[model samples]
Target: MSTHPTTARPMDGTARAAELTARTAAGAAELTRRTGTAPCLATVLVGEDPASVTYVRMKVRRCELNGIRSRQVVLPAGTTTDRLVEVVSGLSADPEVHGILLQHPVGAHIDERAAFEAIAPGKDVDGVTMHSFAAMGFGLPGFVSCTPGGIMRLLDAYGVDPAGRHAVVVGRSAILGRPAGMLLLARDATVTYCHSRTVDLPARVAEADIVVAAVGRPELIRGEWIKPGAVVVDAGYNPGNVGDVDFAGAAARASLITPVPGGVGPMTVAVLLEQTVRAAAVQLGEDPAALGL
Candidate 1:
């Protein structure tokens, strides 16, 4: 493990993400050179929600810069759940498309689960599907939910081993909280999950050696609740650029902490691109290990 400072040290996720991106770009270029098929990620978007549009554009731009191809499939706001599923299924069946990322909040009416299931497990780079969750739980090979995966990477980069630590994940969202806990458990950590119904949330947080605030509510986990020398990963990005943990207070107590905008956010997209390249390598029948992915 790495030595911890007296005060909280910023995890610097943006810098870490850049490191992953550089490696992924090389893997992507090498894959293309060997197989003549550029790694491609298909992003499916429903409706034109401004935030979603901007996020998709950012992902596409990143893909372009990293030597990965991007294919966008847009659907109307009123598109039926089945229609959305059909589009995703087509992308899954497309041999050239190596990874599938279905942007979420696809309107309240759309069956988001069905749309997610339409993506083949092999191409689920964003890791929203149940198969990915199961894979993560069983320590099998599969793409993980990007945020959770990124969080693990951040922990590894900081040399904070989860083994034998009590990790409290305060959220139960399908893609974030639950998966985060599962990943932690797979690393031999004693994992506890707390959600909206969790009684005395602060008390639960206070006992953790590692705290992951993934619930979207802003500053839900107070700094005073954090144990001294604990590692805090604030995965929440609420409006106004605030995190679930009160930054100043948590930073004062924690040995390591992730900031709101740069901490977990950049790592999500970096992992997405990294996994896309790996997916392409697998689909191309090239060994990812041999390619150094």
Candidate 2:
């Protein structure tokens, strides 16, 4: 007999993503009507990591769906950190580029944080920089890391109030994991941070009213560790389209759980587009609705 992971409800990210995409498409259409040029997102990818390539492509495809044009820059494996920084700085200075998404984990030798900092905060639509992180933590006016932002939106849409809830976030990556915990904490969720060195990871997870599995390791979170009636948000995008949690098992016990491919993935691009239009409007010091106004 096969044992299944326990979960209460399966979170349907694909359906929710579709709704957001439809809304973004309409927003893009309006932006195009007002501004001569369609909202454009500049994407830069370094090296030849298959996952990064695929992710960039996915983001670009979603941009098209939302009527946003994308400008792609594919760099070679031997590209130096200074060269990468120069490229990003140029994008930050570009007037027509409203948003920028730097495909991360360039390489062990590449200075990713330096590259992220090169992007102007206003144009950092992907929210991968320390500036963006602090802004989101302070609840200030800045773009959020798309996947984390999407998860927060999902919670709101499902009416899963985070106030006073025990939220245990696993992982500490700057982009997804760290921001996810910060976002939850900001919502008054009483969050706990867990990483590779975290002791009794299972116990911590079992105590969670809300679980955010963002560690890149596939199936790192076991289903039996989840507390009953808890909501599970998986922000992982591991290779082979696997999530950090065991969805099959977790869904058996979770009140809601996001699927691997369709769950947090599509929402990332949606939030990116949402912020891209805002960035474009801000650059011109004009109201976003003024386009529609």
Candidate 3:
């Protein structure tokens, strides 16, 4: 809990993401040159949640910039789960759609899981399907959840190996916290998951070499709880650009910490684009690495 200032370096996810995006763009271009069609991503939006709409718009813009085609499908908020699933299934079966992204929080009554499961595993670029989860958990060759995958890329870019380290992830949501812990474990890190039922969460965070704040609470992980020199990655993006970790406090103790707005957020979209290109390359009978992905 030392308040003294420390020389903590910020994990520059923006720069890292830019580098990845550049590589993916080249891959997409190369794939397009080889094949007659460009890599296409189908984005399905149910209802017009302002935030979700903005997110999808940003993703579509990125696809345009990266030489990937984007198809937008907007449905009414009151759309039935069965109908949504049908739409997703149609997209999954489409040969032109190499990647599928169904914006989350479709609606309260919508069976989000059912819609996600409807996506073909090969086209689940967002990695929301159970097949993607299993692949990530097993370290198999498949798409990773965007945010968790971005976090891993950040760790690698910063030369922070997870092997043999104690990693504590504060949150247990299936997509963010749980998948993050599984990804860390796949890399040989001893992982712990903290949730609403966890007791003395700070104590757990204090013992970790790596701490991931993904509970979607503003500044929930106090700086005092961060172990000295630990790498802190705040994956949660709450209102007003605030993250789950107290960035200022954690920065004082962490050797490396990710910022709220420019850190995990940019990387998530970058991973999605990269995976989309990879999916297209695979579906087009080309090797992803061949295109520099």
Candidate 4:
């Protein structure tokens, strides 16, 4: 390794994710040993959106790597809300399934919240369900939405303290943006959420001590818009895997920044695997191994 210190802190999600997967592997092994059933996540994808397909595949592949089992269920674009709910509800009732992660953008016609509600709260590892949302807002124990959960892990691994900081989260989607803001709030950060309709997006982003780019628009946040030495997190993934922030520009201005492909992406899968293992152990009537803490 080069001895020269990096002027800009590269939040190394690459290395941190390696460590998380290692632990998840062990957890999977222990759960399998005790229950004779591997921990499994049932992924539900509605429609044939290419990005949604890629995301689901990525999650399943990661599950395999971490020694967890994943089951995929695909529905048609024309699938109705009730039909989607039926599939999700069935999966929730399946004892073999420990967790359910339903991908978003389930077509405009489908009632997204209703589909999310079909999964039992305990099996809602993705935290898309109302129960998970309420729990997160209340700072109670529950499965966190995976992306936000991943973001939290990244923050922890980077030693980025959010206490008393201003955290600006762009996007208000249920999974990533909204929950991410709530998480920061729970950590004592004053949080603000901005979206396309926000009057002054640039001003809001520039004000953040911690800027999370969850809005899907590519490079919508400019370099000059960034606060010098602020921490920048690009949670957005557009075509060609580009993130929401202009990486090159943001990286130069940010004291710390997370890269697109390696940063939040890896953590999302890691959180899913972690939650899957935990859900499995709980179903087995055993506490998730927390190093005996």
What TM-score fits each model? Answer: 0.98, 0.93, 0.98, 0.93
Tens digit per residue, CA lDDT, model 3, 207-244: 98999999988999999998888999999899998999
Residue 70 C-alpha lDDT in model 4? 89
The digit string of per-residue lDDT tens for model 1 on 181-207 reads 999999999999999999998899989
Q: Could you give the candidate ranking by lDDT, starting with the highest?
A: 1, 3, 4, 2
Task: State which candidate has the highest lDDT.
Answer: 1
How do the residues 190-220 of candidate 2 rate in per-residue lDDT, one tens digit apiece?
Answer: 9999999999999999999999988889999
Question: What is the lDDT of every predicted structure here?
Answer: 0.94, 0.85, 0.93, 0.86
Backbone clashes per model, in order? 0, 10, 0, 0
Error of 4 at 221 (Å): 1.0
Of the pair 1 and 2, which is ahead by TM-score?
A: 1
How close to the true structure is residue 243 of candidate 3, measured as C-alpha lDDT? 93
Q: Scored by Cα lDDT, where does model 3 land?
A: 0.93
Q: After superposition, how far is residue 96 of candidate 1 from its true place, in Å?
A: 1.1
The model with the greater lDDT, 1 or 2, is 1
> Lowest summed-lDDT stretch of 10 residues in model 3?
1-10
Candidate 4, position 45, lDDT: 94
In candidate 3, the residue pairs with backbone N, CA or C atoms under 3 Å apart (3 or more residues apart, or in different chains) clash, namely: none
Q: Estimate the TM-score for candidate 3.
A: 0.98
Any idea what lDDT model 4 has? 0.86
